[model samples]
Target: MSAATRAPRTCSIDAGSVLEQSDGSASGIGGTGHNAAIPSSGIGGTGHENTIPPGGIGGTEHNVAVQSSGIGGTGHDTAIPPGGIGGTGHENSIPPGGIGGTGHEPGVPPGGIGGTGIVAAGTLMNVSGIITAEDYTKKQLQLAKGDQICPGDTIATNQDAKVKIQFADGAILHLLKNTEISLVDYNYSPQQPELNRSLIILAKGDIRSISGKMSKLNPQKYSFKTPSSTIRVIGTDFLVTHLLQQEGALDAGTYTKVISGEVSVQSTTSTIRLRAGESSHVMLNGTQSIITSGGGTCSVH
Candidate 1:
């Protein structure tokens, strides 16, 4: 014998522009209140009784609401009593819906496996140290002290990625993208030989360094070592970049340009000071010439 199968029914209750009242009275969204006892659709009987409870604006009851269009199995027929009103027997089942209200069921549930989880649009991915387009591929990565970064790693533009470096003595370095820089060493100590030092080798990139704890505690402990010379900051901000000269008989040397603050060059034979609007060239002979800013006798670039 064929089992009995019932069709799904849907009824919507519109509490149009109504709000609940503090006096337990039914208030419409438009601030109108009504005091009356609400009636139900039916209790598994042949009757239609719609209701708005005494203290409720609007609500509906169902006997057996089958939202999905599925076949009923044998020995278990589907039946929704008219007036019985479906109770909260099954609450852990998937609700019938589809992507963006499209309602296209691919013979599977809405939130099936291997589906992208729901999330708020325009979410940003924040990370520490350097972050590039590649880093976002994975869920997470570690960025701890004494970490070395290479080119194209953790790369990002001014708006995409950013890197912040804090020195032992409180110096900070903020680096932007398409920028290559190396953190050689960072030491901050106040004892003999003063272990506090900051060495950054800007191979061919831009870096912004801010003098902080180390500079305030011991101003002499800060240094930005590039390919050319060591930049001794006077507790100020500066940008450093190393430009490679054309290839010659041997490997070409590098030149340093100072955007701001004061940088001093100390070589075996002489000591040169560089200020804003000055440049220096580091030769293969370990010799440096102060191009400008009035340090000493040196060749002009």
Candidate 2:
């Protein structure tokens, strides 16, 4: 009886680096010789009868293999480039199976995916005249060059015909007509809370503002500086108006009206809290408000 002996199989060559020989004298060692290979098992196949399988390195049994680009180093099939995004590797054998990505479960709504976020809705003056002209669907408003309001442009809404200006912060500024209003300054930075401040100087006109999400997060960042007082909102919708009294009348007093939500009115002498539909009057002497029936407007004296 004789024993059958098989030649030693080559060890797997690493895809990360090229194989180096200590003696360096095989057929493909320094020259291109077909028999100079270390065998399909090793770095180079050296036998004429040996065959190189398709999934050579790791083998198809485990679904992993050495990926080579014919370069000096051997790379794993899963190797990712530096500073480059890697693609998710998926499993093909398992049913409903996938590797490394947000997978949706059955009967469940996936969470909202973030978008590029070009601009928030109701962002005014964002569309340029050129783009408006090119797209028929795009609406355009021809604001006069001279009439264009710069950063500090201030205007009072007419008491008869009010106006509303929507800001990028999703705030609605209802301007009362015939009332004096000035845009002291307006800036928004969703990134930084401290620098995200909006200020309006109400010289006369009434204003009803619905603070946006940004303002709600940082209440101290927003202020409405009125003629006789400054209204600071904690987190609610409110109305504020400044009325100029007649030069000669029975009693001329500055009125601080609160349509809805609480507002702190800081008069020359004191701080007064007026609830919804309440009014506080600040006279030369001081501040006063007359309590009325439920939901009734208060008259200050």
Candidate 3:
């Protein structure tokens, strides 16, 4: 009988044992037996062969046939396409084609969401006769009750017409017949009181105005402009009358009367402050003078 051929000696690796390859390379394989964790650098075995079962290389058994640099070892695929950052796979990352980083939606215009374009500055609360509003483009729109009045709009009332406007900041305006006024600019934010501002142009007309939150909070930021003077308020209810020489009825000047509170009327060369029950006249020459009793009435009727 011949001596039994000796089988090749094979060594079994235990937990936390070093695995040496035939090429003299060595790596630490931790954990128990075949469940040892595979290093991110490379797999360890004889001849560097991938002898580990499918999905057994990494601790995540679902990641099969994944490369070392791929996210597959972490249970996620590394094949993310364009615009995939904000997609379902990566909810916290920004997408390439969307504005996730800027708090905007995809395909939004340059001005941002909702935009800051023309917006309603006031609304027509009551309208009588023929009242119209002209925009910057010269487009005229007949106004009715509850009609929106935007900035850059010139509102006019025909003969015997009357209209009342309620501003966003709680101001009130009453326009008499044959009156015209333009809303130049208006900005109001209850949350940001410092940003409140307003400007109205009394071109030719009789108008009564009651101060609102914008004027009450920041009186210096609210103003009304006419051809002859600029009127600023201090939480006041006032009346303004502007007439041209061609009208042939009233003087071609700007007249202001303070019914309540106070106001400052400024011309090119003069400035005057008027309290309740006071009145002033601003001539075309940019001169201001106090009006005696019976100068003008504050009634919009």
Candidate 4:
């Protein structure tokens, strides 16, 4: 151990130091060195009668426990602080809604099944199978199931009753069977479609629209009123049916069924274009007829 304390055959400490002790690590015993390239796991070593212990970076509370080895001296399983391989002991579990896995499908927490049926964009909130609603501002009254159909409303259904008029943008108005629709003006705002508007007034029976999301973001603002004309909507899935083709007179018109999208049927003059399966018929005396699959309906029933 002469030469003035022999300890330099080349030693460098560029910066990162992570020394470790595994019950056996000699740094420079009586001279002749060779153990110092500690770069990526195997923590620096080379004789001095061995002894290096300084790291414990683990368990985060800064109780530090991250090891780097050089020999027979690994702290509780070579690299064990929170349970090896980037572990906090249990493979990053977060689930249960904060989102990670089985939070029960659809958008996870805050997006599904609390309301039970349908929501988000297609917002026809609820209205199951058979339905009812009729509360005239002046006399008649009988409408339940979260009732609220303002704007000069009027919906009817009997004789095998069936009604489902949901709308908040997730549109769906299947009101068949002695139906009698009339909601002069409905303004849905799926966050504002420039102030969406839906003006329906079948005034007889049968309807079946599925154009919602605020009528596919402004489908010319929708309008189907028919004592004889006016059927707009451009992003659709429709089916209107007035009936009475005369005999009694009160109805005498309507019958449009496109089933997919696109409609225009005017009247009081003219304007026609109905695609997707097609079917039309006006006539409150204005006549007019266009067919593809016969015509919307005068009913086979």
Judged by lDDT, which candidate is best? Answer: 3
Candidate 1: stretches off by over 4 Å: 1-170, 176-178, 189-195, 245-253, 267-270, 284-287, 294-301
lDDT of the candidates, in the order given:
0.36, 0.37, 0.55, 0.45
Estimate the TM-score for candidate 1.
0.38
lDDT of 1 by residue, 65-148 (tens): 421111110111112110001122221132221111111123321110001111111111223444432221122233333332
Q: Give the C-alpha lDDT of model 1.
A: 0.36
TM-score of each: 0.38, 0.44, 0.59, 0.26
TM-score of 4: 0.26
Root-mean-square deviation of every model: 26.8, 26.4, 29.0, 28.9
lDDT of 2 by residue, 1-301 (tens): 1111332111111011122334321211111212224322221111111121111112111112321111111112222210001212223211110001111223211110000001122222221121100011122222211122222334443334555556656777666556555553344445434434456677764667777765766667577876566666655577665656655542344565565666666666777666776666655445545333234433332
Residue 119 in model 4: lDDT: 19
lDDT of 4 at 262: 75
Off by over 4 Å in 3: 1-117, 246-249, 293-301
Model 4: CA > 4 A from native: 1-116, 119-142, 145-178, 181-189, 192-217, 221-230, 233-241, 247-251, 255-281, 284-301
Most accurate candidate by TM-score? 3
Candidate 2: 10-residue stretch with minimal lDDT: 109-118
- How well is each residue in 151-264 modelled by candidate 3, as lDDT tens digits? 557889999899998988899999999999988656565654554668899999899999889898878878999999999898989999997764555567999989988888
